[model samples]
Target: MPIQVGDKIPDVTVMTMTAEGPKPVKTSELFAGKKVALFSVPGAFTPTCSAKHLPGFVEKASDIRGKGVDEIVCIAVNDAFVMGAWGKSANAEGKVTMIGDGNGDLTKALGLEMDGSGFGLGMRGQRFSMIVDDGKVTHLNVEAPGAFEVSSAEYMLNQL
Candidate 1:
């Protein structure tokens, strides 16, 4: 089943780019005692993701954090290199934590993986957002295929 409010995030290893290189970060470590606003994109540098989805979060990072969110995270199925590049391009440094679900492990664990083979993209994560407080999901907004609405930063801010 898809992850929902009240569920604790799975303990899976995800990658984040650092000064040295890509490093493994456990999901449990991320949510252990923080109120996190996590959003996922199908892929990094894709049209909508680059133009709107990611920018929205980057623009609203402070506002979201102001509303008691300890961190804002953006996850994608791409590798740490791609994610880091995209973050730099979007000026997301210090505003958002970009994570790489390189093998779709986190996406699969949440049952949010989408088959993108038709578009030659292979397996990717569906666009979604969630508010996790101290290891428990408090809110989840999942977009329908080819749609972008509820998962936007504006909507999530309203929820907060």
Candidate 2:
């Protein structure tokens, strides 16, 4: 079954770009003792993801944090280099943490993997967002195919 409210985030390693370089971070360690607002896009730099998905979070980051969220994270089924570049392009530095699920390890673990072969993208994570408090899920918003309503930052902000 897919990850749901009340479930602990899966223990998996994902990559995040650091000043030093790309670093591997364990999901358990990232969420431990922290209230995190994490959103995942199908891929980085895509039209919807770049124009709306990521920008919404970047713009609303402080608002979300003000509500007691410790961190805001954005994960995509791309490599560290691509993720880092994309984050920079979106001006997400210090606002949203950009994570790379290069191998889809975390996405598969969450049971949110989707087949994007029809688009020549092979496999990717679905567009979704969740609130995790100290490693446990408090809310999850997953979008239906070709939809972009619930998972937006505006919607998540309302949830908070």
Candidate 3:
């Protein structure tokens, strides 16, 4: 089943780019003692993802953080390098934490994986966002396939 409000996020390894190189980060470590605004996109650099999805979070990072969120995270089912490049290109540095779920570990665990074989994108995370407090989900907004309404940063900020 898909993860919902009140569900504790599963412990899984996700990748983040570091000055040294790509590094593994545990999901539990990310949420431990923190209120996190975590958002996911279908893929990196895709039309909608680049033009709208990621930009929204980058633009509203401060407002989201101002509402008691300790961190704003952006995840995608791509490799760490790609995610890092996208983050740099989008000016997400110091604003958003970009994580790469290269193996779909976290996505699959949350039951949020979607097949994008028709587009040659293979398996990916659906477009969604959630407010997680100390590892427990408090709010969730999942967008319908190909739709982008409730998952935007503005909407998430309003929910907060």
Q: Give the TM-score of candidate 3.
A: 0.99
Question: Taking the tens digit of each residue's C-alpha lDDT, what string does model 3 give over 1-160?
Answer: 9998999999999999999999999999999999999999999999999999899999999999999999999999999999999999999999999999999999999999999999999999999999999999999999999999999999998998
Worst 10 residues of 1 by lDDT: 1-10
How do the residues 1-160 of candidate 2 rate in per-residue lDDT, one tens digit apiece? Answer: 9998999999999999988989999999999999999999999999999999999999999999999999999998999989999999999999999999999999999999999999999999999999999999999999999899999999999999
Error of 2 at 10 (Å): 0.6
Which residue pairs show collisions in model 2? none
Each model's lDDT comes to: 0.96, 0.96, 0.96
**Lowest-sum lDDT 10-residue window in model 2:** 16-25
Candidate 1 residue spans exceeding 4 A from truth: none
Clashes in each model (backbone N, CA, C under 3 Å)? Answer: 0, 0, 0
Worst 10 residues of 3 by lDDT: 151-160
Roughly what TM-score does model 2 have, to 2 decimal places?
0.99
lDDT of 1 by residue, 1-160 (tens): 9998999999999999999999999999988999999999999999999999999999999999999999999999999999999999999999999999999999999999999999999999999999999989999999999999989999999999
